[model samples]
Target: MGGESNRWAASGRKATAVGTIAFRQQLAYKTDFALRGFFLLFILFVFIQLWTAAYEGDFDKAISGFTLKQIVWYLVFTEALTMAAPPLCSRIEEEVKNGDVAIRLIRPQSYVGYHFSVFASEALTRFAVHLLIGSAIAWPFVGPPSFGGGWLGLLALSAGALTVTFLLLLLVGLCAFWVEETSGLYFVLQKLQFTIGGMLLPIDLMPEWLQRVCAWLPFQAALYFPARMAVHFDPALLVKQLGIQIGWIALLAFAVNRMYRRGVTKLHVNGG
Candidate 1:
């Protein structure tokens, strides 16, 4: 029992150490990081301006279930939180191609566990430095949208959303093992999310057939559904969204495990 406890403790330490290293590495480029936040703010401001122009004649009318203000704020939060989510699979794929992943595999920790720990640490740093700061700067420009739920409910939904994001991205990253490069695939998948996942336009605005298609897709569970929860809280709807989110998480996890096993055996590490 003591040995088992000791082993667990050691593993925890390793994970923590890996995460810490990643955090510090990101922190080292603080200036460039700050610029990225500025860029996000600039892009967001432009989006708002364009929407304002487009809706000038119809300001009084609600388009697609969102008032201008609500849509503006939704874009703010979406842009802020979206980038803070980790890009682990991309990083792992790069390492694999460059022969760096071999080092990770040789370590005592499992490769996926180690990468996830590092990615989580990086995400924490980004959330604090980029998302939090961006939100603060944009707050005065855009008043906070009314969050309908209690604080506890909001937190649960936010955390659950982040978990779903990580799991989905991780699953997508696993494709690195099978595909030669994931850039094109990631681009297409992300754009589909923007269009179908209700990021670019609300699902309510989408045609009935499109909404039906999105209902089954995992993308909506990633950004759109959670963003909806933040803006409008319906307990029943939250539960339904969470149920679907968990179902996708489980399915993706099973698929990832299968792919990772196959990848480990077939991965040809040519020296880059």
Candidate 2:
């Protein structure tokens, strides 16, 4: 038991180190970082214009229980989260095609753990950057975020949302082990996230039937739940969403582990 505990501790330390390196590497690309922030700013500006027109320049007008300000803020969070996601699916597919996974699998750390550490680190950094830029652009037009005391809860939920997203992407990437091309699958996943996952619009505004369908699917846990909580926070809602996020994370993580175990067995490397 002691040896097992020590092994776990060592693995944790290794993951942490890998994550830290990934975070620093992300920071090193100053030009890319600036470009990402500029892109986020541009997106928020466009959304503000669209929403303002939708509200007919009346920021106080409520649509589906969301004021114009709240809607913009909601978009800010949703877009930030969406843009912050790393291209894990494409990266994994490429690695598999080029025989890189063989090298990665021989490493001391778990292959999934190594990739997840890198994904989480880079994604969290980009998320923070995007959020900052989006918030700066939205604040002048929408005033301050109304969820004043719930900032910590918002951050926690956002992290959970990202984790769920990462697991889904990992599963998609692992599909490369079997099919050898995952771009079509990844494209479909992106569409699901944009529509049913509520990255482009809140599920509340959708038809009741669509909302019910989203509720049954795990996609909303990655985008809708956290973004909705950010703009319209309730302690009870937070607790409920957190539970939902946790459940989705566990289920997706289990699926990822199972798929990875089977996928790794089918992995083949032809060239040096």
Candidate 3:
């Protein structure tokens, strides 16, 4: 029994190794990723032109705490951050519907852990790609965002944001075990994140009441906090937001794990 357990542990490690490789493989298409960068560049330029025009007639130099340049740069960070997240939750939905998760069930590995390893690897890769390309494009316009506390905090917050996002989506994916089709959930999740997480719009620009309400949601912690800090680094706010990010990540991790355990049990009972 002990030997069997040892072999199982070894196999899980092997599965994790494969998960890591799979994520790296996503980077093989250099041309495709570069084109994606250009697409974002085009959008950034158009927004820059629009905002520049709008602000041209304004006597006020800043709107809602952001200058014309900062507003555009804020979008630069948030768009890249929102886009960096993989849509693997939909993949989970499809696999569950098609009964393909059965193959994963017999493997001597934690199914959620295996996929999350893949998600983390891919997310980090994509975040790097997005950051490099976005910065390259933004430099000619807004210049680089000031890094006050160095990149250590930035990287930490980015990782925390991604992890929290993955965990929330993992929970959504686990719901597929029962729902079989999670299109509605996916749609709602995407829209809510886009609107409330300050992906396409900066939360700083939102109405005071709306901002107060959004502050309590995990959505802000997942994307807005990190992205905001990227464009406007503040050591004091970073310390406060980092604590909030850590809290959300931990809480969401526990929730995802709980839902995963419940999902596995249901999968076994249903023989799927």
User: Which candidate number would show the highest TM-score if scored against the true structure?
Assistant: 2
lDDT of each: 0.71, 0.88, 0.78
lDDT of 3 by residue, 5-122 (tens): 9988897787669667967688687887878788888887887778878789352488876776667667776777777777778889888888789877676566776787788777
- Return the clash pairs for model 2, or none: none
Q: Report the number of the highest-lDDT candidate.
A: 2
Looking at model 3, report the run of 10 residues with the lowest lDDT sum.
145-154
- Report the lDDT of model 2 for residue 11: 94
TM-score of 2: 0.95
Lowest summed lDDT across 10 adjacent residues in model 1 is found at: 150-159
The model with the greater lDDT, 2 or 3, is: 2
Could you list the CA RMSD of all candidates, in the order they appear?
3.0, 1.7, 3.5
Runs in model 3 deviating more than 4 A are 1-16, 57-60, 150-153
Q: What's the residue-level lDDT of 100 in candidate 3?
A: 81
TM-scores for candidates 1 onward, in order:
0.85, 0.95, 0.86
Assess candidate 2 and give its lDDT: 0.88
lDDT of 1 at 130: 58
Model 1, CA-based lDDT: 0.71
| Ranking, lDDT, top scorer first | 2, 3, 1
